[model samples]
Target: MEAMMEQREGVALFTICRPEKRNAVNFVVMEALEGALSEAEADERVKIFAITGAGDEAFCSGGDLHEFGPLRGAEAKQMLTRMGEVLYRLLTFPKPTAALVNGAAMGGGCELATACDFRFVKEGSRIGFIQG
Candidate 1:
């Protein structure tokens, strides 16, 4: 699985677990993340949220270029719009939200981190929008 969900001290931690792919962000991953966020928000036990990548290589490396070719312009637009909405939900999550950036955070990965209210980055890690 590219994503994993766990709870600790009322904090719902959603970890992207695709190290071989450098934690590349994909539509499916985004949807899974959104689902986890919604689930946490609705759960009475959850009071915080966190996001991180599995390995040390990357937090997320934007969208999967391999999957983008078949996506039409309209589909791409819709995907981006939906991603924005999901990010908005995360950004405005009622409780404290934090991003654990331990590695490269490119494009949507950086966007995802930026959406959170707080970010804790490891030393020597890259955190920014990369490759558009």
Candidate 2:
């Protein structure tokens, strides 16, 4: 699964499951995030929404360039636009949202964290926006 969602203790946890790619966001991951938000929003038991990445090496390194690097023109725009919509929803989510930055979070990963109401970065973790 590109991403996974679990509900526990009134929190809806969303995990980006792509450690080999540093938890980069691809089309599938984006869809997973959107779906997770929809699911959690409708669940009254879910009091908070939390997002994190798989493994300990990185929280998220941003876009999966290997998957999306080939795009141009309309294709690129559509992908970016979708991501923008997802992030905007996250930012405006009615319930409290948190970003569990378990490791390095770069580029779009950094943006993702910032979209939340709170960010809990792990000790010794790094956060940067180095992407162009």
RMSD of each: 1.5, 1.0
Listed in order, each prediction's TM-score against the native is: 0.93, 0.97
Off by over 4 Å in 2: none
Candidate 1 lDDT tens digits, 35-126? 99889989999988999999888888777777655788899888779888988998888988999998998888898889999999999888
> Model 2 Cα displacement at 43 (Å)?
0.5
Model 1's alpha-carbon lDDT is 0.87
CA lDDT of 127 in candidate 2? Answer: 91
Using TM-score as the measure, which candidate wins? 2
* Residue 15 shift from truth in candidate 2, angstroms: 0.4
Q: What's the CA error at residue 130 for candidate 1, in Å?
A: 3.0
